[model samples]
Target: MAAKQVKSRQRVADHGEVFTAEREVKAMCDLVKQETERIDSRFLEPACGDGNFLVEILTRKLAIVKKKYKRSAYDWERNSLLALGSMYGVDILLDNAKACRDRLYEIWEQEYKAVCKKECNDDTRAAARFILERNIVCGNALTLFCVDNEQQDTTEPIVFSEWTFPFNDARIQRKDYTFAELINAEEPKRPKKEGAQQTLFDLYPEAKPEPDEEGIFLQQYITHYRRLSENG
Candidate 1:
């Protein structure tokens, strides 16, 4: 059976909601094969309707994590979370945003259980959901603002958390920035940060990514990987 590309005629008329087929998604992701496989590499789908592109990227990233860390449950858990944190998505429809998060969580859960087995715990599961909740957003990608139940733009801006394992330990650092601001700033070249596998500026040099004149971010905090639910 073929993957359904159109959900309904109303969705297409209202929001132009059409999912990419599996074959096309895979082919598009294959174009960035190396980046998709890199555990900490960032990928954003501006209109990620039900996560066609994201799930493919996550599947590739998890395969790498499994291949490299299957021997160690600890490594598998940490790297898997890293892979989860690296993806971001936005969909105008609330249902699509929720579906995207659920799809991502299921993918991570399946691999986590297969690799960690007895080591799996609810805290880790909560942490994965936390990342998905933060990464997958319901908003208008054009306006960079969140949407209401009716999919109308709200006053609140769309803010994205930049997640990082800054200390080479269990601690995960999160930095918040408005999506519009991150896209507004630009640097001629990406900088290599001390602890960041890839900072916002590193992953997206165009991101001014600083507290100074170059860029302005919202909040910064750190917590244990499993306690990411404690974060905002």
Candidate 2:
């Protein structure tokens, strides 16, 4: 049977909670086949209801991770985290947000335990959960703000984390930007002294990143991949 698309009439009335069918979800995902298969391409669903769309995207990313990195548990673990980190979701319903996070973790954990069995560690698992927690949000996408249990808007604006292994090392870096900032992001026009071309690092040095827009960040954190749970 097809997966149930509607949870209940009450939910539909309250939040318009109708989930996309698996068949339609897959067909839509196929339209972006190459990006879906790219291990680190980022995807965000403004209204992810229990992650039907995000789950399918993650599944595709994990399959690519497994195919390329399965031989070595180390490679598998790191790439899997990268795949998981790249997905993002937001839902107005708090229950839906929480459920989405759990659903994502369960899927990641099942694949993780199957592939990395003896080599798996709690820290890595926790890191995966942390990524889901940060990536999935209980918020009003329309208002660009977070929401409380009663489905009312909260004072806090919606913020999303950008994760990357900045260096070719085990450490991961996270920088937070408001949903508005990202949506409004544009290339900064540069000034030239007539004959000069400049390297990117000249403007954005390694020690300091010069964002095009001021106040684009809320906070930043860095930690070893396995130890990411400790920081955020």
Candidate 3:
């Protein structure tokens, strides 16, 4: 059956919200076949209504992770986290944003449970949910501002959490940057001085490194997950 395109006619008129069919989504994604299959390739959907595109991208990436790392629980968990981190989305509607995150988490949880079975637990599930909460944001992509949850009318700069994996350790380092700064990283900026050109670094400042205390907490969290998996 063809999925319902929009919730209501009023929504279509107000937000110009129309969902792409599954077939069309596949056709468009096929254009970037290589990137879609690559585990670490990052993709951002500016108007990701209910995450039709992001869901498909995650499915593809997860399939690759499964093929390569399914046998090792640690490898599978790490690669799965990497795959989830690579996708990002923004939607103006808060409900859509929440739905998208829920959908993505559901997809990941189902797969993890099926493959890992007894090994899948609450800690791993919570990690997946945490990644989705950061990745799929409720915001105005054009303004690069997130809607304040407490006050719907107010907006805050869209700060994204970036996760990095180190080769020597299992700890994932995190950094934060405003969406505006990240997107404008490559755009040419007006010269700071009359005769001087602006460098890329000047255009986009470095991401804020996580605080030392937070880093310690994050490592502890990961260690807890490892200990749970081992005890199981």
| TM-score of each candidate structure, all chains considered together | 0.87, 0.88, 0.78
**Candidate 1: where is the Cα deviation over 4 Å?**
185-214
lDDT tens readout by residue for model 2, 1-232: 8879998999999889999999999999999999999999999999999999889999999999989988888888888999999999999998899999998898899999889889989999999999999999999988778899898988777878888888767777777778876787442222322324222343335624556354656566667789888774
The lDDT of model 3 is 0.72
lDDT of 3 by residue, 184-228 (tens): 542222222332322223322342223654222111112222332
Candidate 1 lDDT over 25-134, as tens digits, reads 89988898999989999999999999999999999999999999999987888899999999999999999999999999999999988989999999889999999998
RMSD of each: 7.2, 7.6, 9.8
lDDT of 1 at 189: 31
Query: What's the candidate order when arranged by decreasing TM-score?
Result: 2, 1, 3
TM-score of 3: 0.78
Q: Alpha carbon lDDT of residue 64, candidate 3?
A: 94
What would the TM-score be for candidate 1 when compared with the true structure? 0.87
**Candidate 2: residue 170 lDDT (0-100):** 79
Ten residues in sequence with the least summed lDDT for candidate 3:
216-225
Instruction: At residue 69, give the lDDT of candidate 2.
Output: 88
